[model samples]
Target: MDERDGKHQDAAQPEFRPYHHPAAGWGAAKSVTEFLVRERELVNGPRAIMKMNHENGGFDCPGCAWPDDTKGLHLDICENGIKHVTWEMTRKRVDREFFAAHPVAELAEWSDFDLEDQGRLTEPMRYDPASDHYVPISWAEAFALVGRTLQELDSPDQAAFYTSGRLGNEATFLYQLMAREFGTNNLPDCSNMCHEASGRALQASLGTGKGTVDLKDWEMTDALFILGVNAASNAPRMLTALAEAYRRGAQIVHINPLVEAASTRTIIPHEFARMATFRPTRTGTLNLQPRIGGDMALVRGMAKAVLEEQKSDPKALDVEFIERHTAGFAEYRALCEATSWDEIERQSGVGRAEILTAARVYCEADRSIVSWCLGVTQHEHGVDTVREIVNLLLMRGNLGREGAGPSPVRGHSNVQGNRTCGIDHRPDEAFLQRLAGVCDIDPPRAHGLDTVGTVEAMHRGDVKVFVGMGGNFALAAPDTPYTSAALRKCLLTVHVSTKLNRSHLVHGRQALILPCLGRTEKDHQRGSLQATSVEDSMSMVHLSVGMKRPASPHLLSEPAIIAGMARAALPGSNTPWEKYVEDYDRIRDTMAQVLDGFEDFNRRVRLPLGFRLRQPARELVFRTPSGRAEFSTAALPDVVPVAGTLALGTMRSHDQWNTTIYSDNDRYRGIKNLRTLVFMNADDMRDRGIRRFDDVDITSTARDGSTRTLRRYKAIPYDIPRGCAAGYMPEMNVLCAIGDYSTQSDQPLMKHLKVTVEASQPAG
Candidate 1:
């Protein structure tokens, strides 16, 4: 009955191979070629549309959160950007005929690629349970049905509103406002799953929850520690910054369990010779492969080395900065000095000599920056791990200085912006008060459910209505079967999106898909072509205006969709919902009054590259209770696994971004046509009687003594550390249990998993 049964996909065995090359050479060329082929029908539209992308008049690339160098900007978009734009600007359409030809049950059997590749959704569709097919529905009826279902909820708490990173700042503001007006704070967003820990940790230590350094700081740093992130596959444009740092004699170190191609070498396509020959530029000066979940200990070992070095040279440490600007250094220094090398080595799986080598580089550097992604924040102790990284930077007087600070590299395009616009369950009281003052409604003071809590609430029948601004929740969330069941239990589920996704198939009793305009299309409302905005990883807000015509004349912009639903649902509410939809500037003006750093929001966003939001830590001011940077004393996590178990980590493929799988091949790792493949160390594979391409059954053990098994996954030998395995998510997400998450931040432990892999019998 579910789409995952996959009856429509080709049952033939998938192809697999080892890719052998650094990133951004021939592989990037292939991506461009693929984009050309995919968008052949609307060829000039893509090229003309791209000219506006990341420019003053064009839209921001709806890909990564990496900032654009607007001062010296070219097209400035990468292959990934092209693919995203091309995919959005494709000529294909899913009209009434397409829906008539395919039932919901049949569409469920299609793969993720097939579902999205069917083309842009041209009209609204409602699930007809009796027919098992989606029937065309007018926007008015769809909005009215959603409103009726929501109004019928036993209590406001029975509704959960989910927001994704793709939503524009204006839409996010309206979405959260509508939820608050509805009297519930269940504004769980994608950030709750990815970087909630980063926000929690950074806010505790630095007064501000966001990263302090901007794009310009990359040039001034003397050393960089890139941890737990596969920069090449995730943020291809970031490699340019890394390459520039290395070129300028900055020591670059990559700390990851697997050797990512971009960390080793990358070719900047903007450079002529490399673009012609696909030759690579060297990146990482040191590549450290510590045991899975050992980042805290590894960082502690580095800190201990710094302390030892300072013993001989007291001036080696930033005495003035530490004594004046930070707290808890005395106790922290004592703990580091007293720490045993054996314990550090055992916990980190790193030798003392190697630790000292990296520490020495840090000691010699004038300024340093530490950047990390989900790898460091997807552990049970994610908050503690990030805190230790902050401790390391504080030891060197790195904060508030040029080229030195902590940057939690966000994966999504506007996830940070979504948080800025109040798409959070735990809203700060001051922000709520501002919203109340602006909207004349009593904002809910009680904290609401996060992603995990939302799922649990849905399962318990406490939440009956589910509304997703964007994103495929069923496929992106952990514990797939559980999450899917929660969605099915809902009285109504709605998704505002550009194309069909798996989440549409995993429906509730009643489901609605309201197709919307993508970032590549113009959004003309209030008799004007409105522009939307997004915040980059560095907290820089910029305007993004779509150039091409909308794929469908019927598709509504997200703000328009939210307005229709809001007016219908909150009939008595007095907020100017139509005004926001008519002119996005009104929403920005409201944000300027409501949010702390968004003063003059409309004026600033109209600039060529927008403006940077205020970051207090940028000026050495700590927003903590102590009025100074506070050091954390979290101990290393206890991560010992059961005997014969391998630590499993889930990651995205080269051809994927977040949950959107562009292709089956991870070209950087040399994988092709096999998303069900697992990467394992050769020694570990041999020890377990497993070989490359061997059929395996992988079981993930939950803390509650339960397990979920994935069958018929083929194991591939790779350069990963021993006793560690890597697999693509959504396919592997089912193995993760619902209760598996960080205790402090409530973020899922997506990267750290306990699993046992065994050889399985092949098909008869």
Candidate 2:
């Protein structure tokens, strides 16, 4: 092999090290300047960053809230986040000429990263079959067409409105309003794909859809159970809290199939080279690597261990809290006692000793917190897994404590906020009743379609029109081939976004692209500047103001886009849609009138750092139907390995944010330039007769006669558990079938799939 090929092959090898991963937000050198040049279109680079930070104050970096040294006003965005910011602020324009030069068919073959890197969509465009290109259309014409399509639908259910968590509260509220005003409550946000399982489990157990702990709660917690999450890369700001927890003698236990860097020591750049270069920041006290799709088993083992320990020493559990505040403990205890340790050990890949040790630590701690992200929620039995985790916490009376509760590490800045502000498929009766009062129109009481339901409807031709508020639907979904085919069945598709993405290429017959304002841009409505609110994972609501100017004068705010669409869809509807757009407070006032937590939305949201929503459970108040906390006992046995098969997980690259790709570089894995590859255990690779750098094919055994195969991927061996493998999603989505989704939450189980792999034919 040549030097370049040899270097690439060498870099592809997996090196299992024990150091903390690179800083995700603030540690990358030149991240700010690079962002200014690429995302902000500032010719003066660092000068632009300085000006924005001083006078306008650069908007919260449009990145993860991994804490920065705000005292020193240093920029704290990560490598990927910098790329995300720069990508959004990019001057690269995908105008009519760009479209005219490339047909939709040709663009479809381009990688997801390449398609988005071309830059922002500058004008409204509609797909034309004859020309095979998206031709620019007049705004008036586009809105009229959208109205006509929605109006022609046989029923409101025939069309669906989808929202992404990345959207601001103002935009999400307006988008939901448009759907409700159009006579359908079919509003499903991106949460339907990621954390719906967490919401379901938490709401059923505690009567709250969000986490019971706030950011301040960390200060009081004695121990933290970081389950199925990689906070180091996904949310680096969390490391600061964890580091503090370590310094305070709070034990942190990390559970995941991957031995991520965050579970080790990290260098804090903001702390200066004094500690950064010499000493690594301690992140976790214990690290456990369970098998893929084995979270349920691991959690069950933990609960079982807790129960067994409590039997020997009654003081091991919080008997007072359990007797006073919980129900169904007897049945749950019986189930745990009957569960076999051999089964748990086989599935979790962790011995009884390890589980008992973790359980003892949790029991001894006055306050213990459990936090998980997509890892625990993106499985066939994700809901049960979360329910079991709650069971473990409840056994020790951890619910509603200062540092003890379940925390779902949410994706996207405003995903949780989107759900908070009425972007739900199944709105509760109380929330719906309040919403009806706001608009003076009775909203739909029946449940609406979720992300999977919407896709299925489109596939069955039951849905004719699809409207996306912000996310790239085609790219975020599993089974890319099936999802693309489903999109083709829709008669009309509308995408309101800031940049050009792959979803735009997989279009309906009459697809309309609506360009909207980015979070980094100043939002001007009527005569005043507007600010939007985003709810973090801790239920802390904060106000975000844009510093950069609009990428284009023609660009409209998401709220305005929804209002314009509403005007067209319902001509002469007496609702003051235009008035609400002019003033967002009026919108917040209406929202507050309908939602219980925001009694003083306008005044409360104006605070320097927004107000926290009222959460009774944070103080240990149970609002369940029984007026007590509930415990569920369901033990997940190991997935019996077939004669020849493995559990594969679909993941995102470090250079990627959801479906948007910044580059092919995955710095943590030492991967750069290329992304089409899978990471597998070295033993598994050898046993399957697959060699390193060998082109391999992964085929999914669909229940139907059809088979989906992802071809020509290089296999890179790593230190993963046996029977566990991982490949990047959107590309390997083809392996996931249409019906292969979680039954309870309807979220796609993209993280867990059964597949067979073999060598692919060499390129002729």
TM-score of each: 0.97, 0.93
Itemize residue pairs with steric clashes in candidate 1.
3-108, 19-670, 59-545, 207-623
lDDT of 1 by residue, 1-764 (tens): 11122111335566656665667766786777876776684465456534644556777778888888746656576767777777778788888888889888888777888888888999999999998888999999999999999999878989999998899898998899999999999999999888999999999988888999998888789999999988887877888888888888999988998888877887887777887876777888998887788888889999998888887988668989999999999988887877789988877777889888889889999999999998898888999999999999999899888999998899888999999999989999999999999889998999999999999899898999999988889988889989999999999999998888999999899999999999878899967999898999999998988877888789999999999999999999898888888888898899899888899988888876788988888898888999999998887776655569988889998888777778777787877667887899999899989988888888888888788888787888998877788998878888778899879999887888999888976667
Q: Candidate 2: worst 10 consecutive residues by lDDT?
A: 1-10
Per-residue accuracy of model 2 over 124-201 as CA lDDT, tens digit each: 889999999999888888889999998888998899999887787767777777788777878877888899999888
For all candidates in order, the CA lDDT equals: 0.86, 0.76
Q: Give the TM-score of candidate 1.
A: 0.97
Best by TM-score: 1
- Highest-scoring model, lDDT: 1
